[model samples]
Target: MATKRFAPTPTPSLLSSFTTRPCCLNTSLRALLPATRPFSSTPTPQNWLTPKRGESSKSRKGKPHVATGGSVRGTTLVWGDYGLRLRSHDRRISAHQLKVADETIRKRLRGTKYRLYHRVNANIGVYTSGNDQRMGKGKGSFDYWACRVPVSRILFELKGDVHEQVVRDAMRLAGNKLPGLYEFVRKGDPPVMGITKVGLVGNSEEFLRRPRVPVEAPSLPHTAQRIPGTTPV
Candidate 1:
């Protein structure tokens, strides 16, 4: 002898009174929402980022400090009227990050006459191993391309007939997409050496020469010499 099972009665949702048709509610919501450009589903162009064929797939973590040991070169605006310069510590900026920032600037400046300059390229390849993997298998596999950007280095430069305010706004928005602190710079601004600006308010010659000076050994007697297994005196 088995008991009979009964079907449960359905209940209407509270929202059913206000929105009789689900499609109509969806349409109304869409109408109230702002339209936005869809994110690109296509792969990034290899020409814009990927390292050239035959290039090393992995690289050392190189410093942004130039051979001169100062952040002089690549820190000033050269071709563009305005630029975005890093103001904090150096870091490896990935190709994807760069593309996002570039797209942001271009989107904001759409319909404007302007030329954007990429001061740095994502030529360095970064590699990583799988999680929970044992060591000694190798340096892992190629993960992404990146460029080492030193502090005070200009990442992007823009020049055109666009108004200063508009360009500034565009750059500000773009900077937010990038890592680290950034400062808006203009043409003719003083070049930066490290965190300090060269030739600003002080003797230009002295400021320029400070980082260029080579280290010299102190004058010593003729008897003074490098001891065995030690550095030179």
Candidate 2:
């Protein structure tokens, strides 16, 4: 008997056999892929942190040399008695710059009770005779006389430009906020009292000045005279 044999046809290529569903991917997985569009590599604004170079520390110093409590870069309040000890550096600071520093401090320390004080001393120049120069001597000098206020009264020292705006906005939203709080207003031609101690010490001309007013004054009796007793019908 003779047997018939049949040859099998060759199979299609593996690539041809495989199927794809439009290259679909999950939403989260799509996020992992690189952005197709060009991106701007700009950094976002940062709050509660010191400004970068070429940015003003509001004219006091390029950087705040003295930060008391917590790490200067952290969000938590650095709790401690912060102070500024100005050394004579031929440069003098401008009035505007002092305003900047005051505002900066108020903004950074908002919601936290911290005291601030300012003091001025004679800068004994590197090789000069007396340490008699006050801070804020130069129009743009880095050296300046300033102090931190007490933690309790810190909120009252806010400046008009930035700090006042913030307070005004807050008040508009909440209405008559921070009641009983007092603000220190700068006065006079240069808008600063010459050097005076936290209580009164250094030269006045070159030092940062605070407003002075009698905190407690007695009220006098009404000067108007009373009418004689009269009966009404």
Candidate 3:
């Protein structure tokens, strides 16, 4: 019966300052590490465009139709001097696309004295499920956030001491990142309701209220008209 005895290894100069006990080593390590501030579980506010907490996150994909009454809200610049207005059909724009467009404008107008305004909020949450999964249980988890923009609705506006050309160029670059056509609009411009612009002197209510007169079809000449149930000789 023989017993083997191993030599105790020498501790490095780094560990010479603290005892080799497991408890002492742990305490020593904690003391050597830098103190970290506790981070809040709540997410930092992204922007005003992001929906607030406790608000309804899931929203139905509603049509971007303007009511017949014609309210001119978001049709013209409210705070900014210049704006980018949608000129095409209504559609839902995702938050990512909007962010890219925003970045594009900001990048183009960097160092300029301009305050950009966002007319829309990405509060609507879109949900989707796996393509192979069978439908029936429930709507899948949220996929992305989006905002509905109707025809002639302003998306972004700029206000500040910036030049008109610079503002126009920035907006033009931004428009390329987003879907649908967009036009530059200025302050005091006529408000647009749907595809029609409400003139300064025109009443939106009256304009929408006007009835359409249907055009009558032109009558065909005798030589061109076909006889009913008659064979041509």
The best candidate in terms of TM-score? 3
Instruction: Return the clash pairs for model 1, or none.
Output: none
Which structure is stronger by lDDT: 1 or 2? 1
Q: Relative to the unseen true structure, what is the C-alpha lDDT of residue 30 in candidate 2, on a scale of 0 to 100?
A: 53
Q: Could you give me the TM-score of model 2 versus the true structure?
A: 0.19
TM-score of each: 0.66, 0.19, 0.67
Tens digit of per-residue lDDT, candidate 1, span 105-132:
9999999999999888898888888998
Candidate 2: misplaced stretches above 4 Å?
1-80, 120-233
Error of 3 at 163 (Å): 1.5
Q: Is candidate 2 or candidate 3 better by lDDT?
A: 3
Error of 1 at 85 (Å): 0.5
Number of clashing pairs per prediction, in order: 0, 24, 0
